[model samples]
Target: MNSSSPIASLTKHLWSMMYYFVRTYIWLSLIMGISITFLMAHLVFWYLDSEQLERFVSSASQTSQQLHSNLVTIFTHSNNTCSEQNLITMREDLWRAPLIKDVVHIQDGRIICSASWGNLEAGLVLPKPTIVWPERGLQHWRAVKDPIKGDIQVNMVSDGAVAVLIVPDNAYASIPSNYPNTGFILSTEDNRYVFHASGPMAPENVLTQSGSSWRLLLTQQCNTSSKALECVTAYNAAPGLFGKGLWFISVVGVLSLAISALLHSSILFVIHQKKSLKRALRRAIATQEISVLFQPKVCLTSGRTIGIETLARWHDKHFGHISPDIFVAIAEKNGLMPQLSRLVIEKALYQASSLLKTDSNLHLSINLSMSDMSDPSLLSFINDHCSGHRIPAHQLIFEITENSASGFEGIESSVARFTSCGYQISLDDFGTGYANLSWLSKIKATEIKVDRSFTQMIGDQDPYNRNTLSAIFQLLKDLNISTVFEGIETQEQAEYILRHIPHATGQGWLFAKAMPIQEVARFINTPNSSIQHNADAAR
Candidate 1:
């Protein structure tokens, strides 16, 4: 039967429609199931982030008040005049004050004595304070460059008669490195951001007044015997796609994907209960009843079909169409994945031979199971098929799901072996499994396919969701690895990905549906195919 004949075209069109319908339902189910998972995870993470901020601010406030009490005690007990004995007393007090670098005596707007330098040979004339607390007669000189200290900057706080010089760097020694975004500021009780030793948590202008660019996490007000000070902590609360909120986003994202996968598996489980799916799947693979379809992966920037992913479709005469998920799971559980994988790879390479010969740049991506990765003969099996089909190994991309790759103990070496033989390895369904960031280094994948769930988040304005996507994209970009986004169903999603990740490629209904080999060939050969037209339209 000629593929372009009316009957054949009608059959192909019907198949395409059925495939689209089934896939749409599956994706919708997956999305729906995962929505609750994400919502719950987001709530949990948000609570944690807020709790952490509150705890940190509370601790900072307590520490500030304690230090303030100690400073006041030192000032009240010391003599007002710059006496020889008084200088000795100040020097002794320095041994108990860890945060204070030095203490100096001030009289009539002049520095007369210091702890480091017992008595000044010539009194250093004091300049006007940067900030003044008239209520407590407190004066603060912030970030003052001192010639006596080799021109190093120091913060000076005084109560007319005595002063303390503090190192700005030492002020934040208690903050942990993990909280990189955490910032601290000292403000007066009147909500005025005082130029204190702790310095401004955000930009000077932003700290001076409330602005949308920053978010105040929490504030703690405490009395210091003389005056009241507020301990302010905040972060760059721009509500960006990714920032400090990535923790919440990633947690939600991972759980959502897990729920989606579980929902898909449960659905397939219920469908295959009436029949012996494992037996049917085994027989289908043996009789080669399963067929392969090619889905084009289009370059977001160039609007070109760069490659195709080979998908397996099984239509059992009695049971009707069986999803690849069901059949593939049956194959894996029944120790038939090796055979199924080999059959699919052999067919794909052979079928794509002519396309490969015509265009060297075009690659065929094939999914590999844990069984195949562990099989020592898998490499030779693929190489033999490629050799017979006249297709170069470089033109073949072996995609391994995160779950499969993580399950295999020696996946890194297995993947490396294939890559060494010129086959490209792509981490498929990334972020949908329990694999951590270290997994990428272990597998050394040439590319990563961003999960459809993540693709669904492209246009989401939620801070956590945006941050999660941002973190994922930035990590891939930083790794300098190739990325492909899957399940891009809308023009808005495509544009969002392209705008953020300019070099990425994507596959979804918006570009083209999975098609038969004949349609795949025509779609690839057609210069102005609908895929390119859609891509252009999207741009």
Candidate 2:
């Protein structure tokens, strides 16, 4: 078997794991998103319907109140001592008033005054009382005790009469233009019609009385002219609006799910390709497919290289130069991150062990992801590798990004394990992703790598960016945790950090680009390399 057989198997396993995870995640997300959207639409429609009903009821009630108020005003203004002839004229005037259907002056429970409708003879007296008069022609009526004028006087010889006004039911039927389907009724408490207006009422009469007044009731049907047309249109359209709404939601849901499936398929395809690429890369690592690069971490004050951060580089025989970011992201997606991390640790440890024999003070920093922190076997792997190589744990620093500290289930335990084993912990990309000051004490990280955002803006004349960096550096200093400013590509940035945040250490292209392991070794070994000379001068 080839030396890389084990890595090939691991890569295949990683590809399988990634495919399942992506598929599951896509399915779950699409289902949830579509379901929520449909539910929200349903809730919106229900809310609109409820608001329409409430508005319709409110408008009807307002009209009724207005009619009551108008009648009370008219009755209060009338002279209670008016003679029969004068009462007849008063009734005629009131009957002509807008919304008053008919006005009848009742004197001693007799219909003495009425509006002339085809020689009906205004002020005609009726035998006995017209208290139980036929309601066949009446549209609507309302009887209200005039609060200001009090009740009308009644004699034992003659029952007191009420001034009955007959108004077209059209007044109450006048719904707001927006709600044409709404129906209304305005009648006395005893169901007497104040105005019987909706369409022609049936031949049935419901009579009831309030106090000494007789009231007649009639029923009218109401339908929205527009809604009736809309209903017909909707029915002819096969599926109605409600059904169409549901169908639209279903289509959206199906499309979303289809897209999710496609996405999942694409992810699987990429993951599978990555698995092959990783297999080839791992074989290269085992047979030297990957090359280690080192960037010296020089002491800001001393200017001597105190540590080197290990960076992985790859150049595939089939595919030319691959970026660490591309491969690293693929590795993470394909579940090969743990294996990759182990490989890096092994390579770094072996190199550090060799370097330590010559320079006992030299330190090696290796980057770790949140996945590595939760890996139960990671601590053991590190301990075993170091012990096998006879390297002290104190010489190694495990660097983790700020994101790893957020909701990291076993992070505290992992940190404790590594720290107890004499491995230094550094929080990398400190200003990014949940970089809480409180976590510094909790994780007991020995170092913090200030994110590129703050470092890039270090020399900016913008007060906002400058002040923010100043605050962050000061905060780190107060915490007693050393900070390394990342992405320093300019002389201005270096000067700014040195002057404003003198306590910080940094590494970037300004110092040295990550180079091949051989180049790194040669640079370190060079007696008077600019990096070494600068380090010595700074110290």
Candidate 3:
């Protein structure tokens, strides 16, 4: 075979791969576009409905406020005159205000005026007003005292009549024909209806409160009163609105189904294409595609390489390059993070074991997820792997994120079990979650990783940031837990930590990016590694 024929075949294979991805992309784009459109339309409708409801309620509340203000004005003016005639005039004025359903006035234990009946029963005698006081009247009185308006219902008896200014029960029942299905009923503090109006399409008996001033109830019904022109307008609009909503929903549903079918086809195509990609990646990993990159942690006081944080890197044969951030998220989503994590742990242990043979004092730290912790078989897996590989459990540390440890239900038990197994537990990203020193102390973590936020701000001249770090460092120190500062990218950051928090440990790009096992091994064997040089430079 010609040598160039193989190269041409490789080129054709690459082109086929590209064509597959492009086709998949087109299908995914169409599906995603449809999905996004439907979602956005639904969101818009939801938002509009919410806003409309709020506006309707707000209008009702404003109407109630006006009525209350009018009543209060009438009471204030009449109380100043302190005359039965004045009260009678006030009642008459309120009755003619178009919205007021009824008005009854009580003065000095006598019903001076009654607007609902259009007459005052002058010769009638009434019982004591105290009988109508609701049980929670005292609480209402306290709430309404002074600057706050009183909304409580109290019994008032005068001239053989019980006069109560009630918020009417059906205020929302009589709204004008043109208005939407919206109306409200206003009640006094005692839950008695004072004013009520209704519209043709309003909801039935929906009650809302107004900052304790009034209780508003609302309801609506379809208007079927007239077969004439005016009633036809309302009848036509109701069906139109309902039909429009239904049509929109139906169209969206059909489109969504189509999009889903397209998406399913596209996903299958992508999966087929990715099979080759995955196989190449697997082969690379089998032949050392997985690399152990070390980030150095230095002793703040001595500026020595006290520990190394291990990060995993992957390279694919067909895909050429891939980011762990992307693949890791994909792996987790695909339920493969456990397997990926196990591989990393095995490789890390094997490497750490070899390094330990040369230098027993070195520490190797790796990150573990909450899912890993909750795995019933994890402990036994670790035990088996470590024992088989001749790796000491004490030499490896597992870092757990604070967000993962939020619900401490099974965490304590899990931590205890791991600690008993000679595995060190470090709380990663401290001070960013509900995890405090009390929680840390309870869990009895061997180490706490101060979030990169604090480390990044350590060298800031700003007093607030400096003071915050100082307080956090002091708190961690008092807890007798070792502190590891993450994301130290500069010599200034290292120096600031050394000067301010001499007891804390530091780790970041200031040391080195994570490397493969062999490369890390080579660095460890080097007489003067970059990690040591950086530490010495910092000193």
Tell me how many clashing residue pairs each candidate has: 3, 19, 33
Residue-level lDDT tens digits of model 3 in 1-539: 79999999999999999999777777776768577757766566444544554555555554455444454444444432324675576666666454544445544544455554434456233343332334422111111111111254232211222233433333322323343433333334333322233444332233332221112222222112111000011111122123246677788767776776677677777778666655555555456566666666667665555677878887665565678766666655556667777778877777667776666677789887767776768778888988997777787788875444455677788788888989898988888875566557656888889889988886688999878878987776677668898887877787666665567787777765666656666554445344344445556
Error of 1 at 246 (Å): 60
Candidate 2 Cα outliers beyond 4 Å, as residue runs: 1-288, 402-407, 525-539
Candidate 1 vs 3: which has more TM-score = 1
For 1-539, candidate 2 gives per-residue lDDT tens digits of: 78699999999999999888866878766666566655655556445544554565466555555554445545544554345665666566565455544444454434554443322233444334223334322122223322112243211111124354433344455555433222334333334323322222221222221111111211222222211100000000111124235677677567656665666567668768777787876676567566677887755555566778999888887878999888887777667788788888888788667776567788889998867877779999989988899888888888886344455656788788788889999987776776655556567898888888887886678998878877886777677767787887776676666665555676888777887556766656654344334444434
Would you estimate the TM-scores of all the predictions?
A: 0.49, 0.48, 0.47
Weakest ten-residue segment in model 2 by summed lDDT: 227-236
lDDT of 1 at 359: 88
Considering lDDT, where higher is better, how would the candidates rank from best to worst?
1, 2, 3
Q: Candidate 3 versus the native: TM-score?
A: 0.47
What ordering of candidates by TM-score runs from best to worst? 1, 2, 3
Alpha carbon lDDT of each predicted model = 0.74, 0.59, 0.58
Pick the lDDT winner: 1
lDDT of 3 at 316: 61
**Candidate no. 2 TM-score:** 0.48
